[model samples]
Target: MSKLADNLNTILQRIKELSELNQTSVRLIAISKTKPVEDIIELYHAGQRYFGENYVDELEKKSNDNLILTQCSDIRWHFVGHLQSNKINRILTRVPNLDCIQTIDSIELADRLNNNLQKQSKILNILIQINTSNEQQKSGIEQKDFLSLYEHIKLNCTQLICQGLMTIGSLDNVNTEDESDFQVLIQCRKELCDKYNFSINDIELSMGMSNDYERAIQVGSTIVRVGSLIFGVRH
Candidate 1:
């Protein structure tokens, strides 16, 4: 088998082992931003269907390419970066098969996307991004504003299916397994589920990355975005 396939399998196996111990199923999103299409195809052929891209233009090009559309029609594209309001139309129009936007952090962004999707008679899946780390530089809704934004989406954004919550764990807290950010997400999920009369298991948690996914899974992360460990370092 190819090295890329081997790496992909290793990550899957690790996820399986971890999830089994945690008694929760975790979906793996291969963050393919900045990587060549060839590499993405390699992983695609190896049964990796969920791929994430961070940039709008790159995702548009990759998803719109005749080659990729023809060959990998089943590939699920995820937008895993900060999304701007102005680029919403560009993304919604260009990438017809975008499965999920994992960075919806504002009521305005959610409203725009919902309005556009309503025009197209489409329903888009989205996750509310939380700035669990409270970093000034991150592009996520603060904890204080999370519920209001979530309520706004649920009430007004009829075209959006609120999948769950997503956040990037604190970089400084990674090595020690602090997972405080992750814990915050878990608590939020529980609180939201209770308030909404929804099942806790149904509220997905899109946390964790290459460095701390295991810890994330242990704490109830339903989705893990892994990039470097599977695709090798970005150039």
Candidate 2:
């Protein structure tokens, strides 16, 4: 097997081990940022179709080429980075297969998404970013403000659909496990969903990175964003 495939298989095996037959089924989004097209192709060949890209340029470059078309087009593209309103059009235009955007931290961005969705006549899927660790440096809504945004989005916007909540665990010196953060996000989702009377069946919990994905799965992470594990460390 190729090195990429071997690495992916190892990660998958670890996920299975950590999951331990839990009701939550973990999905790996092989974060293909900074990696060449070949690495992505190898992962696709190894049965990985969902890929996360932190940068718009990289996502466009890889997903646009026809030589690797199936690995790009047939795959699901997730935006796992901070999003800029001005850059929305570029991403929407290039990454036609963009599945879910995991960082909706502000209502203005949501407005931009809705406006663009109306212009393009497409419904964009998104996740509200919750600052689970309560860290200021993190890119998510403060715990106190999440519900207000959730209510506003539900009541005001019809173009952009909220899939669920996403969060980055704190890098601060704390004893909290990755699963703890993941569960906090899930709890936030449950509270909002119950209040709004929205169905949680189709919603997703886009938590976990390379380090804490196993714990994320144990705590109910439907999608895990793994970067360095699949592509090696980016410089």
Candidate 3:
């Protein structure tokens, strides 16, 4: 078997084990940012459906295949990056099966998504991006400001659906401490759900990356984005 196959087997085994312990099914999004389409195809052949991409251009190009493009539809393609307002229309035009836009931080961006969706007559699933590390330079709303934004999206926007929350943790230690951010993110999700009385079944918490996915599973990440571990490191 190829190394990719071996790596996949290992990750699946870990997911199964973690699921049993946590009593929660773990969804693995093979983070394919900067990776070749062939590598994603290899994993797709292995029965992996959910994939995450960081760049709009690259994601749209590769998504020309059987891959799902948008962040809300039948198949799952997560826009797990710092999204700008300029890119919203392109995303809506191309990727149809895009599952969730996981990095929405500002109301302007949210309004843009809503407007674009209305123009297209579609409803896009979204997650509010939280800066769990309190990093000013990061692309997320601080925890304190998330509730009002959530309320606004829920009440005003007909084309955008607020599914849950997403965040990128401070990558202090790739192996051990990285899960800290995911844990905090999970708390933020639960708090928001409680505040808004959002249904837990429909709510999602998209946190975790290649380095700390196992820990993310333990802490309750519905979607874990694994890039280097699955697609091999970008050059």
Candidate 4:
């Protein structure tokens, strides 16, 4: 097997092992930001279906690229970076087979996503990005604001699916056993599930990354975004 495939297998095995202990079913979103389409094709051949991009244009070009269009017919693209209000239209209409937007932070952004999706006659899955660490630089809604944003999306954004919550953990917490951010997200999920009258399992948590995914799963993470460890350093 190629190194990319080998690395992917390693991560998959680790996630399986870790998830078994926690009784959590985990999905891996391979972070493909700044990486080449060849890398995506290689991993796709290696059994990776969900890939994430940070830039709107990059995702648009990649998802429509001839290589990608021909090769990765079923690949699911995820927007995992900071989404600008202006780029909402670009991402919604162009990127084919787009799966989820994991960085929505506010009701305004949710409103934009809903409006654009409605124009396209589509409904896209989304994860409300939560500022679990309360870092100034991070682009996520605060825990207190999360409920209102979620409620708005649930009630108003009919074209958007409230798939779950996503968080980019603080850099200070990476590689550490601290699951404080995960705890904050758990509380966020529980609150929404209680208010909306749904099972907690109906909502998913998109947390963890190459640096601290194992720890994240120990607490409870349904989706882990891994990049360098699987695709090597970004190009």
Candidate 5:
């Protein structure tokens, strides 16, 4: 196996260990942002099924790459960046294999996604990104509005499925013992379930990246977006 495969397998093995300890299944989104499609193909052959991209134009081109289209048919794409309203149609129409939007931070974005998905006769899985750290520069909704956005999507957005919640948390607190943001997300999920009468198991918490995914899994993160550690430093 190649170095890429080695890296991926190592992460997968660690993920397995963490999941086993936590008694929870975790999905790894090999973040392919700023990397070439060839790297993605290598990882796909190494048993990676999910990949995330951060740019609309990049995702459009990569998703349509002939090499990728022919080789990685079962591959899943996730938009792990800010969902700009202007680019929604581009993402919906161009990226046919998109599996989830892990950054639905506003009701307007949700409504537009729902409307566009409806127009395409498609239903999509989405995660409402919460600014659990309350960072001004982050691309997520404030934690206080999590309930309102969830309620709005539940009531009005017929084409969007609220699969889970996603967050980057605080850079300072991620790998440390702090996890206050993770706790906030856990609390938000509980509050949502409590108020809406939905099962807690129905919600997936997407919190974690390359440095701190193990801690995230320990705290109940169902999906972890890992990049540089697997794909190597981007050129």
Candidate 6:
């Protein structure tokens, strides 16, 4: 088969092996941000239905492309980037088939997206991004504010569905398998479920990337955003 397909299979096999070892089922999201639509189509044809893009304009353009529309209609687009409030309407309007957004980090952003989705009578699935690394530059809610944002969404934002939580682990500790961040997320999920009476199984944890996904799966990451490992490094 094609090189891309082969590469995808290798990554999937690794994920499968790791998931089996960890006794956890993990869903893979191909992060296709800067990659071409052709590469996306190749992976899609190879049975990859979930794809992620970081930029709103790129996602809008790619999702609207005739090639994606005709050939990969079943492809699920995920907005896995720091979504600015101004661009929310454009994204909602342009990418109709956009599936899950895994970067909701604030009540204001969540409210804005919910309001935009309300206009279209759509309930967008969202994951609250947690800054587990506590890095100043990272775009996620502080551990303290996670529940406040979640509660705001649940209480006020009717058009947004809170699916779970997401986090980008510390890049500095990538090789060490420092699962402190993952542990924080797991504990947060457990607390939320116990305190709010939410279903533990319903809350998904979106953590891990190309470097530390195996550790993430071992600690109960339901969705893993793998990019370079499957698609090769972006130029």
TM-score of each: 0.97, 0.90, 0.90, 0.97, 0.97, 0.96
lDDT (CA) for every model shown?
0.92, 0.81, 0.79, 0.91, 0.91, 0.89
Query: lDDT tens string, model 5, 20-128?
Result: 9988889999999989999999999989999999999999999999999999999999999987899999999999699999999988899999998898899999999
Between prediction 3 and prediction 6, the one with superior TM-score is: 6
Query: What tens digits encode model 1's per-residue C-alpha lDDT throughout 1-235?
Result: 9999999999999999999998888999999998988888889999999999999999999998777888899999999999988999999999957999999998889989999989999998999999999998888999888989999998999999999999988868767768799989988898898889989888999999999988889889999999999989988
Give one digit per residue, the lDDT tens place, for model 2 in 3-114.
7888899998988777667755678889888888888888887899888888888888888867577544578788988888789999888876888888998888888888
Better by TM-score, candidate 4 or 2 = 4
Those runs of model 3 whose alpha carbons end farther than 4 Å from true positions after fitting are 65-75, 173-179, 199-202
RMSD of each: 1.0, 2.2, 3.0, 1.1, 1.1, 1.3
In candidate 1, which residue ranges exceed 4 Å CA deviation?
none
Off by over 4 Å in 6: none
lDDT digits (tens) for residues 18-130 of candidate 3: 97898887788888888777777777667778888898988788787644333222446889888878898899898756877888888888888998888879888888998
Clashing pairs in 4: none
- Shift in Å, residue 233, candidate 1: 0.9
Q: Supply the global lDDT for candidate 4.
A: 0.91
What total of clashing residue pairs does each candidate reach? Answer: 0, 0, 8, 0, 0, 0
Q: Give the winner by lDDT: 2 or 4.
A: 4
Deviation in Å, model 3, residue 46 alpha carbon: 1.0
The C-alpha stretches of model 5 lying farther than 4 A from their native spots are none
How much does candidate 5 score in TM-score? 0.97
